[model samples]
Target: MNCYECVQQGRSEVAVAVCYVCGAAVCVDHVRAESKLLRGPASPGKVIRDWPARQLTCPVCRAAEESP
Candidate 1:
């Protein structure tokens, strides 16, 4: 698939990943990676915090998220 952002700018760059939030295809230049901690069940009363997982999003979604 081609990058949504690149298409807007009249470029046809190959998409590397899809945005996790809005499902927009994005290339390396348009992809935003955000690390988030994942919580999982460990024991009966304990929760484990795993390593931060990467979440990809388009620039539009990222900007809206940061705004409010």
Candidate 2:
């Protein structure tokens, strides 16, 4: 089977569910998600950044990260 997101690579034997936000076709050994609060400097105003945890992401997802 092919990955629903990538539609290019064959699915792994233990493919994991994809993340709705990033559309990453993660495998059982690569799937991971978590919430984090990032605190920035106080000079420009303290900023709290909530983001998803990293995992063994696919090439497409990696590309997205690089672009952003």
Clashing pairs in 1: none
Query: lDDT tens string, model 1, 1-68?
Result: 99999999999999999999899999999998888988776897776768778899999999999995
lDDT of 2 by residue, 1-68 (tens): 33444444444344576755566555554544444554544555556555555545555565666694
**lDDT to native, each model:** 0.92, 0.53
For model 1, the local distance difference test gives 0.92
lDDT for 62 in candidate 2 is 53
Question: Against the hidden true structure, what lDDT does model 2 obtain?
Answer: 0.53
- Displacement of the residue 33 alpha carbon in candidate 2, Å: 5.1
TM-score of 2: 0.33
| TM-scores of all predicted structures | 0.85, 0.33
